[model samples]
Target: MANSDMCNSVGASPGAIQAPPLPAFQPRSCFACRRRKVRCDRQSPCMSCTRNITDCVFPAPGRATRHGSTSAQTPKRKQAHLLSRLQRLESVVEILAAQVKGPAESGTLELDGAGLVGQGIGKEGRGSALDDKTARLGEELGLLVIDENGSVYIGNQFWAAFRDEINQIKQVFDNDDRQGDIYSAETSSLNGSIPSDLTRQRREDSLLFLFWQSRGQDVPLKDLHAFPSQLPIIWQIYIENVDHYSKMLHVPTFAKRIQDLQGDFSRMTPGMEALMFAITMSAINSMSNEDVKIKLHAEKSDLVARYRTGTEIALTLADFINTTELDVIQAFSIFLDTVQTMESPKYVWSVAGLLARVAVSAGLHRDGSNFPGMSPFNIEMRRRLWWNILFIDGRSGSDQIAEASLHEEMFDTKLPTNVNDTDLDPSMKVPPITRNAITDTTPILVRSEL
Candidate 1:
């Protein structure tokens, strides 16, 4: 009857659900620690195991795991091991957090592999800013840097000249859409043939058509000086760096003429046009890519390409080879100077020889003192040119890995007067006597002396 009662009780719970299978236990303590009832550092051979000189083994997961099983560690030892693992996990998480959050919150950008990154701007926001506003627009340590807000920063060498006006000039940037994109033809096959000349009907405007004739195509006149607004920005860069060093242009008069004719390109002589393009090209060449981005908000390579093409077109229009024009030669000189470092030595050598030939033909090699009819002002300008040509020739030779194109006896042009710009007026009769110790002219004087 008792056996019958027990059977009835066992059958009574037949409808009840069975318990889920127990998961395997992953042991944290090494075999040595488990045997000695001690903690394990969980290293390949734990510290305690190392000191005791015993075999260290980790427990592997298995299907035989059970809370009631007597084959493994006591509950207290298992709990201690679990606690140690939790602490290690927490510490790793903390180390990861520290690595993610460095001190400064400012955004920064790194461009190219040159390591020239721009410092980022502040990230603080206004009342309307989103909660996730900490994200940056762009950040880099470039030659020039801009932040999310579009504030620009350039190097001191360039900024000193135009820092006062670059902000207001952003209004001019709105008109950037007006400028046409310069297209570069990418061809798979070689096309060496030149396009035929413009029609006779189109050639009615001979001078205008002449500019395109030598360029070997029918080009729009409006395309000649594309960005008129950027004239001030680039002109300032040229005057500050190149003109200050070269002393080629008479700043007092030349600056005035440029300002007057700036609004009217049709009134500009081809020689002057060439000079403008060459100056702007050199101005760009003097700057880093970053500086171009901040000031012009354009790529350095693009600006150089456009202005260089313009220079070639303008020089062709001026008939630079056959002309006795000072502006054309001066333009040639400036263009050569700008390209000396940027172009291949072989190419620069060829251009340098071309400049030397034009300069010699213009009598720039002879001393101004040899001419009786020339004014002191003309003499001074000629002296500057003569010496500059020689300098260019010497540099060109160095580019070609050779000596100067001309010997000492070839030209006797004296060094330019050390007088200030104020001293040499076209209306002046006698030359200024005393040379100023410090003037804008002072630099070119030192260069000539060298």
Candidate 2:
């Protein structure tokens, strides 16, 4: 009896027979709540899951925590990094929300295509939404400064965008064994040493070649011109990639004139000079830096900057604001096409406005049919130029700026005919019949219809 009573007392007080303690009760999140990254009540069907009408699924029970579990011993560095990342994500969301809400409140948001004007847009919505946002963000961040002379200082903010891009490129090359050597070679090339692969194809008469010859000196008038052997390639790229949709030039006629010029710029007018520079710049702008290095042995940035400068100088020489030259207007409009994507919207809009005013004074807003002595060819070309001016003005304007450069009722010039470029000639005495079928101007025509 004594032995039995002792055994029962020991069993009742037993530490040796006790079960191990489980982890603190972890409230199970339903699959929907977990997916949404929200807290969940440990119900069969969580509120979120029920509200969302999702399948209420619970994860299987996990093993209870053991000593020295990783969950309890996570490094402070990792936790800090995670918290920092979350904070950055929240900041980005806040900035984006502000951008969206600001535009909405002002009713000045401009979409990509300005073809749809006036469903309910207000008078204040005359400028580009992008321009408004750009101005707002730039001022707030101290990123952009516009001068009285219209020069924009955005170098600091411009490069800020490339921070992540450089890292991305570095990440791609990080795994390579030759990263140091690759970087060294790139550094050498950037330090004015020509790449070995590019040296063979480099020509003495190339535009970049000319730029190199005058690197630290004032370039002479003659040096601004080029007789590069790769003219055919640039022409090909322009006609296919650029002119296909723009329909700015009468390709067949312009090609013939260029062929006749035979790289001679001694007799070229200032307006013509600007147009040529714009053409080359636009072509180079369309190509990749690597591609340009391979073909022309020049830095793409250098080429573009030089030609853009040249275009500005030539326009100044032509007195674009006062002088009435068709070529000058054409050159300015084409340069706008190249820069509208890169330059400030305000600057582009300002220039586009000037172009429209000049165009109006030059009688481009009127149909050539209203003029009695205009040749058939001149009339057609004039129509093309007028429509192009209108389109460029529309493209550069904001959705909610003041009175835009273009208004539909302000011009009487008709849409360009859908006739092929080959059919129209500088010497054509009779007006060519318009075509019902698709032609060279079909792309422009389709856009015009819109």
Candidate 3:
């Protein structure tokens, strides 16, 4: 009985003293709150945990050991680092938006043959669009249109057609078979040869011949004299040619024979005056030495004294040479004689040939060469050939001339020779021979074989 009482007193008796049960673990808020050293409310379905805020996770029951504490803190530290990274990302997005909304807007982007927004399109449409844009740009810049075709023709289409018609006229003039005759025999035979009294009739016949030769297009004879303002640009060129030629023929020539020409000289008109001045200037220029400054000055002084004309008279004569008048060559020859009292040896044949054509046009001769004194023409042709040689000599250097001379000799001898034999050394310069030296030293009538 004493042992039983002692066991009860020491809680050895059954159910005398039982140890208290451990308290159940209640999870706190998330790991983020704990790492931040903030107070966490021990709640079920915690606000941070339910919101997927893993940073606020609480420790598990019986995990309050030293190892458990370190493991819990690691997760909390990672969650806190991740939150800081997310906040930095938000700040970057806001800064980018602010920069984009600033004052400097994007500049205009330029594209090449393909326009802006060059996306899906057919090949043909793309090509056409590019061409249209190019053309528009060219027009804006005032640039010439150089397409696969040729130059742009913005004027009347009639002028373009008329140009084709005039080209045919040039072809007729260039014909070799109709060498001497201005008018074909077939046409001349249709119209009888009228006397000088029928001047009006002759003019009409000439106008018809000109029209027929030029593409046989129908136009009024009256319209030939006064071309219509509405006529095409090409026809304008023809009309101008006709007017100039008509005026040219009416100009009287200086007396071929002194006694028979006095009456003609007395009846001189404006046309005659212009013609005479042109002829005199051509003659003077043909015979003039390269350095004929003294002669030109003297002629100017004489013109001022006798004709009381300005320097413009000489300039006008030069302008006339470029004209398409039928009598230009002959008129120029006559003028040449008047300038230098000496006969022209340079252009006599060309003048004769041109005159023969004029005479044939008048139904006087079908062959111009049949006219008397073809000797002067022959002489002039030879002189022109030599003149060309001298001109070439003046322009080329010594080495070029030496090579040319050697080539000529080799050809003449019909032998093979090296270029070295020609002595084409550029170091040796050759002074040009003066035009006066060529004219004075060379005999105009010299004839050599080969």
Candidate 4:
């Protein structure tokens, strides 16, 4: 009885000792109250949650404490959003990869027989809604630059850097190494399907015959010296306006070639005339001011007329597929860029492909070392012409057409030396050959890298 009395008396004073302060009632609100920012009413189920008929649960039961506050939840929400965007980006990449690797898989893509002008491969308006959103995301994420006109320009440097980061993310979703095999199969399928011998020969013969018939035998040769007075203006316009667009011709070399002709217009080959006219036309067409273009077009109407005429004459005179003249290739290359007869970009692309085919026919893809007694000057000129064709093909041909007639692996021509034309005087003991690294600075190194 004494022990029982002692135990009972020890805790007897604590019976009404404030019930341990009721956990201090620091307002640990329900989820609905916190999210909606309403008053919690300090109940087990808050007034806001009960009124909204929600679960009335707290995300963090001790959310009244600093560690469980809004500040602590912000980073988690942000992380979730970032994760969602990354997943979307991966989905876009997979679609594009499928398109590139296997065209048949891209059901939305409509391809022509030539496979040059496909609807969805690189063109707008044919992509899926997801693709459109991905393109918008590209702008938001800085993969593409959007101008005020809404034109998108892919930044190669940014792409190279971002590609590495995206590739890391790709590993999380895609583990298949079969993409390489798929791409290789696509390429082989393109290359493996060869025309029959008769078909190939017929095609070659037709192209040759077209060149043969284009030459108007009864047409009189237009005297180039008749316009010697206008030549200075043409040269000036070419240097100022057109040369930057395509740096295929060297001024000093052209000047030397002209001097060697000794002012005799009759001595100029048909190919040379075509080249001159093409340059003149390009300079006239590329005038920046609208008024100036109109005035120049009216004043140079004769010159404009001669551009097509001269190109036709050159093509007529040359043996075409059988001819191996570097000037013929050069003339056609500039002509492709200068011709305004066709407004479609695909026209220029197809013409550029034709020029590439002619170049390959001339063995320009091979090193000059294989040719016995080939001059260093001729070798350099071949290198220049080949690289220029590649540049044109890549820029004008691939960008719009999405098909390349010339493949880099099929060619082994070395890049021309980066020296200026005067420095490369071939007459002076075959000007000393100096090699540049593939990555070295050059006025036209993009084609070489490609």
Candidate 5:
């Protein structure tokens, strides 16, 4: 009676009670779950196993507890626990999918040749999605593509890719060779080296040809005479070149041309005299030595003598004006127009002073009665006259003054008589004695006031 009472209290039927049989294990869930740490349902593609997305497999039937009694309850307990774990996993996967696919998908998706559905690419066929994307990117950025076979090809943007690939290939080849001799030879061949002197000569020849073509028959000669004032600028270029290249080559032709130009200035019109003077100054500045200077000065003296003789024989301003040609007048006008606007006021003043001396000698302002309404004391008229004389004398220079004096003496059939030594600075010194000098000198015809 006592035994029966104890069995009843423990809820056993006289003997120990056997546990109920556990469900069969499945291969679709993990062994840890199958051992009843969690349940592995015998579902083919089990819900707990599939939802967790792990490599699901079962442990052997006898692999649980030592008595084998716990094995019967293992599957049931693991299935229940796995069901709860799977529910949590499914929720986590849903949260991840939502996070990945958010507002970005609301906009239009760009599709390339790759089989990518979203930002995460999916591979299809023989080529991977990554491979296809790489190829597309290489093409866009003008990169070269190297195949699995070790062959190279211009991916896209053909020219740029081709150039880069070629350069890289060359660099590799160059490294293998180690000696840069081949590269140097190729570069030399491509560039075709030339001597610096030859290059300079070629350039100068080209410029000379151009100038010759533009100037036609006139070239050096006509240009020299046509624009007497610009002679200085022209001479400057020649002089600079001569100085630079003197050791390399003699410029005898250049020197001869310069000499001829100096001679030509004497015959220029009175209007262009200032331009000639400027040219003379340029020649003086360009002379290499004292001998050249003296020669130049002597030539100037001869030119002045001829010009003076010619003008003095004319006897009247009309005669002088009539003797002048249109070309001479035009040339003179062109020169004056250029120099009048020059930045150097000294040049202007020098030209003006020279002109004043010439006009006074020419009898253009005798008793101040020649020009209508002009006064000896009229500053404006005097200034205008001064400018006119300056323009002429500056272009002609002292040579022209000497020439006029010589002409006057020759026409009168006498030598210059008034041989006074003028003060070097008119305001600073008295005129020198002339009586003794006049005895041996030729007589210069002095015109009376009109």
Candidate 6:
């Protein structure tokens, strides 16, 4: 009777709903399991990947997978995300194609294959900013290129620069829209108002943090941050040997300018700071075992760390992105030459692009002789900077999408006269351009038809 009563009680209760049974035939195996030649639990990662601590990726739906079988196994959201990426790629290609075929007479673009275009501006627009912001964005994104005639275009190679790095960065940062909103707000506020005392403090703190992160800990922060009286010796070493390796800098001018600055790190510009550290590091690299490597208990490695730290700090402190100074270009040029790595080809490619854009923004790409108020010394400096950029581009290898931004054809700027900084005064009349072999000059002028 009890059994009968219990059976009746159980039957009276509602039956629990069960998930529908999975199909007896498996749709597809997980990638790892298939590769291992084993069966899968048909779970997202399956047991094998979970056991091995590996990522489990499945083929997208509506495609034939590794086993030669089409599976509608991908989630709806994933399919949508992939579709969005495809759309973006298509849109990018289309926009580039339009820009490439755009009317040439509509705007003036400096054709070093960097797409530095200016619209609605007259002849002066070529050097002055008309579309600098757009040009910078394209440069930063590695999307655009200009030809020898200042013709702009976009090509397949645009996406190739740092492609792996971009993917990895994307993985770490999924919500770009949110980040963009925050950035816009920050930028607007920064541009609209003078920074408060608190804001200044925050900035200082951030810079300090950056310095600390940049190898400041290898030695006393003060040692790394401040320029010492003895710093000139290291710079002297670098300047003397610089000509043997590079023609990007005018050694006499650079040395004299360093002397003029008089070891005041505080007064030094971002470009100067970058150049200082670059030279210091180069000097350290060039040192022999017999030479003294220790100063204030700081070894060569410590000094190197200091210079590297100082370079980054100075770059940020001087607002390198918005400001384009000749000093900064020289710094980047030297830094590029000093640092060697397996990843240099890709890294230097982007850097070369940046230096090119900076040169264009400064109007160094154009002939300055036409400008009425420009000094002879200033014109000579601009010419020197432009040619130096061309040399750097040659060494670093320009982006695959475009040739180096500063081309020989567009540059009508006269070559710098082969004269020492001390001999040529700013007040003196600028010398006429002459061939190097006829003048018996250094390899810098003699090697090329400048």
Q: Model 1 RMSD to the real structure?
A: 30.3
Alpha carbon deviation, residue 219, candidate 3 (Å): 39
lDDT tens digits by residue: candidate 5, 218-278: 2222232324444554456434532232111113433454566564655544433433333
TM-score each candidate: 0.51, 0.51, 0.18, 0.46, 0.15, 0.49
lDDT of 3: 0.30
Q: What number of clashing residue pairs does each candidate have, in the order they appear? A: 10, 9, 11, 0, 25, 6
Task: Judging by TM-score, tell me the better candidate of 2 and 5.
Answer: 2
Candidate 5 versus the native: TM-score? Answer: 0.15
User: At residue 351, what lDDT does model 2 achieve?
Assistant: 73
Residue range with the least summed lDDT across 10 consecutive positions in model 1: 181-190
**What would the per-residue lDDT of candidate 3 be over residues 1-450, giving only the tens digit for each residue?**
899898668786566768554233233333554455333343544555546555434445433433223343243443454345446445533532332221222112223332221111113322444455334322222111112211111112222333433433343334323212111122222233355448544453443331112233343322222112212321233223321222222111122322243434434332344444343333333333432244344443333223212111322332322322323333433332233222233233333333333322221211111112123222222223222222222223233334332122111111111112122222324312234332222332121211
Per-model lDDT: 0.60, 0.60, 0.30, 0.52, 0.33, 0.52
lDDT (tens digit, per residue) of candidate 6 on 1-450: 999999887767788445455443233455676577444555666777788998866543332432332453234533454445556556655654444333343333334442333231124334655355434432332222222222122222344422432342353234232211111112322333465767654564464552334533444323565356667777667756664444555566667787787767667655677667767766665665346355334566556656766666655555454455666666666665665332357666666777677666565655554333346766666676677667766656744545544455444445666755444446657544443443212445554453
Model 6, which residues run further than 4 Å from truth?
A: 1-222, 225-229, 243-257, 260-264, 288-299, 340-343, 398-406, 432-441, 446-450
| Candidate with the larger TM-score of 1 and 4 | 1
Candidate 2 per-residue lDDT over residues 1-450, each given as its tens digit: 999998888879847486554223323445676577554554667676777788877655553353434353133533453345446546544543343333333233232221211111222423544345434322222111112211111222233333433433343234233211111112222323466547432431232331232344355555665455767777887898788888888888778767777877766777778788778778888888898899778898888887776766566556566545667777877888888877778877877888888776665765554333356776787788788887777777745374755776565567888899988988888788999899988888776755
Off by over 4 Å in 2: 1-218, 400-402
TM-score of the candidate numbered 4?
Answer: 0.46
Q: Write the per-residue lDDT of candidate 1 for residues 35-71, one digit (tens) a residue.
A: 7755455566678878988887765533234444436
Poorest 10 consecutive residues by lDDT, candidate 3: 409-418
Off by over 4 Å in 4: 1-219, 223-226, 260-263, 288-297, 300-302, 340-342, 370-372, 399-404, 428-441, 446-450
